[model samples]
Target: MLSGGSTGVGLTARDELESTISLARTADKRGFHRFWMSEHHGMGAASVSSPPLMIARLIAETTRVRLGAGGMMLPNHSPLLIAEQFGMLEALAPGRIDLGLGRAPGTDGATAAALRRGADANDGFPQQVLELLGFLDDDFPSGHPYRQVHAVPGPWQAAENRVSTPTGTPQTWMLGSSPYSAQLAGQLGRPYAFALQFGDADVDTAMRLYRENFQPSDALAKPHTLVSVSVAISEDPAEARRQAGTSAMAMLRMFKREGYLLLPPDEVQAYQPTMQERHILDAYTDRSFHGTPETVADRLEDLHARTGADEVMLVVGGHCASLDREGISLIADHYAMPRSEIPLPVAAQ
Candidate 1:
């Protein structure tokens, strides 16, 4: 089932992060399998500056759900560090962690440069990926005998509180909005997560390409596709529309803004949108699985069955604050649980 954490915008970034963790923990208690967060940089709209770090924190906070970076931009940092950080998290959280890597810098050129630690413009991504894989495998031959080198905090030990790391590396995934990413994920035998929040310009094509190019690895013997969508679910469609409206307007505003806009839920209804807002909202609206739990569940099931996707992730409450405990209750009861048999804990105050 779909699950998400906070994107952390404005003054609420930290608090939102906590709330997201709380929410994900609650969802985990309710049986959602995975919980993820997106990565972003330097736009006042959302504070997803360090998704890996945030994911590590989330791993610490939740129990059963797999914690993942909806994506960490690959080009922005050293792959070794990414491997190390995720390796530690994998060790800490074991089977319940996912590493979703992306190729984009997640920011514009200058900001990308600032994040890159002075690396030249053409740093090798394919090579970096290979190196990362090497590190994940202890048999990579980088070192041996006298001084063996393996990923620190590798999945060898089973801590009392942490789950065992499934006798292999963390489940690796690739996130992209393009066919190229689909091809790459397929070729690498990793799961593919499409950023439907951006736009599904070629979603079907991407999925087809992924399945066509797929090569089986130890982690995935076949192709598994996941699509991420922005959704605002509430009993009141109009209220949901109004609440997610600011985010819709913010998205419209981004055509001229320096960075992408991911408007928060609280700001949706109160903000005045521009003339182009209707068009922007409509475009994403086609993809959003909103409405009541039954309606949303029907839409979600249709999307999954149509795509044959193994899973879906929704960014709920992005544009509306009206969704609360009861809304989540509805989702947990009907949409998230396998048989609607699992009882969710009382909502956290």
Candidate 2:
């Protein structure tokens, strides 16, 4: 996943976005199937404050690699606007777009209110999601009132507004760090991507619920899951730690108080980690794939098998710029897929 540099990390916002785009282009050249960017706000570290626009811009600049929000926090914006924005992106990138929706307030309450303006603060997110579906689906009759409200980047009311690819349009996925999102994905018959970065260890339970309760629908003939893994790789684990400092620290500040993710590796190498920091980081340790190519492969295999995930979406943190090229190459090689044909797979209907 592409992140707006970590909040307490050293890199500036501009650098984060530019570097993320550059790395994505390289990943396309490396044959990775999906490229997901994160969305956040009120956090000083990450500049990817807005996900939909970022995806739209990134899609315009790259050819392969399905682009989407690791997730768009649905509670932050209007369902109509979200549909319209993604509708336009889908049109531009065609089958390459993936809209992974999340129900959390991406930011704290104040920031959330500012984004939604005078809209209902407590508006039902589930109800909003249903409305969003109606906007994206073209089968809606012309007489529908929402059809008259045009989503600027794309037409929201018509099926024809879909993103066209050599084969078809973009697909949608549901993202969650908890069981709620997993169950919702199952009910909707959509693919699910879990967020393990927040140190959430209940992924197994969530995944199980998703698969077991999944109801077959026209969008999906069977169940599928994507597990998000935190990956940091370098020839030397020590060097990797240095690059991950700011991000590690950001996690520390937000979740703890003492350490930082952007600190020089040698410095943190000597200092002792507190029990709380250790606990928090340990929770995120599930798919902790770090080190060289050999190490990465082993971790990847283990994570895949443990999660029973059909795909493993990665979240690269800290000073990830320097590691992007090599990291993407290493991952693509481990997957055994050639550096071509990285389009989103056609979902079974």
Q: Work out candidate 1's RMSD over C-alphas.
A: 4.6
lDDT of 1: 0.67
Q: Would you list the clashing residue pairs of candidate 1? A: 243-319, 244-319, 246-268
Q: Candidate 1, which ten residues in sequence have the lowest lDDT sum? A: 340-349
**Collision count for each candidate, in order:** 3, 11
Misplaced by over 4 Å in model 2 are 1-8, 116-123, 139-169, 244-246, 256-274, 281-287, 340-349
Candidates in order have lDDT scores of 0.67, 0.68
lDDT of 1 by residue, 254-275 (tens): 6666355556655544556566
Per-residue C-alpha lDDT of model 2 across residues 55-129, encoded as one tens digit per residue: 866775677778888788777777777777787787677778888888776665667678766456445766666
Q: Model 1, stretches more than 4 Å misplaced?
A: 1-11, 117-123, 141-149, 155-168, 258-277, 317-326, 336-349
Task: Give model 1's TM-score versus the native structure.
Answer: 0.83
